[model samples]
Target: MSIDDTIGVLLVDDHPVVREGLSSILESADGITVVGQAGSGEEAIVLAGALTPDIVLLDLRMGGMDGAEATGHIMRQSPGTKVVIVTTYDSDTDILRAVEAGAAGYLLKGSSRAELIAAVHAAARGETVLTPSLAPKLFQARAKEPPPLTEREREVLQLVSRGLTNADIGRRLFISEATVKTYLMRTFKKLSVSDRTAAVITALEQGLLP
Candidate 1:
């Protein structure tokens, strides 16, 4: 690729040695350039705004503004820039947080050199990259996550928890009994329960209702 077509990358890590190693590996490849390096997430955000690099390889843990938080800032400051998290963390919480914060990729630091290069290219192409072993963890975490409940649904569930019938709930909320039933049905579906008791129990367990 021509110089203009080359991908610009910004490396963010707390350790200078880590940055140097990453730069060396990436610079050894053609069509990829390490444009800048930052010692912290705070610095990463500044350089990201200034350089507007095509990709940012970020570390999850830093002195301040951890990788997930930094990813959010970088995305807002430079919408065209793709942030790829390069971290040693592979926990479900860590991976989910980074992904939810608008990361383009999540790669473990233990990844092979070839995998790292491939992930960078994939992220620049607008693909969601995850360490091969972490994909299942991500999917399982998402599956186990409770569906978000609407305010009205929570209100209905809360009343149900108090032993209120559909009619009583409708009267309390100033809605028709049929409307209350509709809300309950919707809540049941969302909570994946077939009955009111099951729905209430599931909601309580998931903290969807107080």
Candidate 2:
């Protein structure tokens, strides 16, 4: 097919062999082309700007910038370019981070070539794809009960976790104690907890804390 008819893809992986393998797979697929290969997120961002691929097959873990970081940068640089994370990580945190960073799809490294091709096509068409095992995690992410706490609430809860009193947290964050208390109260209501200790515990269990 012609370049205009093909699905342009930029493969971003740290390993040369993996890139080569993925290139071969994509090359044999119909209407798909490996327009460029990047060895790091930094390079991927640069190539995405230059090549303007329709899709980016990104790896999760790289030296300088990981897939989540790369996805954010690529989407910001080229909003039309879809980012599909191809990685071995299936942890809730990893998947959630990539999704939050605006990944168009998430596929495991062990997925069949057909699945990979399908994911790339789906992503190119502005569809969301996730490994079957990851679907539950996505639901759980959305089902985070009682809604999410604001950044300020999380900061106050983190301070609570560190055994900081309201006065200390207020001083440390350059806010008045009343403001800190306000944040804490909002956090408590969101987490369905009455006290700082319970709020921190709930945040930790929900993976809202770093």
Candidate 3:
């Protein structure tokens, strides 16, 4: 792309040194510009909305809001902006949560300069990027084993198995009926089943229920 077509980037990291280093690296690359930096997730969301960067490099862990929550807000605030998580974490849970929160890419902080540059361009073009080490984990999380159900989901499933209606389940779980439905839906996806009856049966068959 031409210089005028440069991809705008916002770096979000809790560490000033990390943000400075990334800003320098990304700014030196062709067709990329460091538009802003933020030290926390809350600030990142605000900058993302204001700057409307082509890509936002977000840290997964921060003092408050965290990357996932910030990502969700950023996406809502600027739907056209892409979010690329650049964090020290590479766990399956971290990757899945970031993706579920609408991240366009996930790369470890240890990624090489070349990888980082490429990821920025790719993310700006709306392509997903992941470090090689993280790719397998995400794929496995999506396809290999069933997603580990959340504790809330387990409770919802057990209540469903006990012939409780959504209202009863909500009261028993001390959550709203809508929240109970949400938990059930998430459980259904995790168990790879449809409907309450199917989810309950699958959970029992897989020994996922107590």
- Number of the top lDDT candidate: 1
The number of clashing residue pairs in each candidate reads 0, 0, 0
In angstroms, what RMSD does candidate 3 have relative to the true structure?
8.4
* Model 3: per-residue Cα lDDT over 35-143, one tens digit each: 8999998899889888888899999998866887688778877999999999998888778868867899999988999999999988877788889888889977676
TM-score of 3: 0.69
Residues 1-210 of candidate 2 have per-residue lDDT tens digits of: 235779999999999999999999999999899999999988999999999999999999998777887787788779989999999988876787788778998899999999999998888778898988889987786666446788888888888899999999999999999999899888865654456665675578679999
Question: In model 1, what are the clashing residue pairs, if there are any?
Answer: none
Better model by lDDT, 1 or 2? 1
**lDDT, candidate 1, 91-119, per-residue tens:** 88778768876899999999999999999
Per-residue error at 129 for model 1, in Å? 0.9
Colliding pairs, model 2: none
Q: Kindly report which residue stretches of model 1 are placed more than 4 angstroms away from their true locations once superposed.
A: 1-3, 146-210
Name the regions of candidate 2 deviating beyond 4 angstroms.
1-3, 145-210
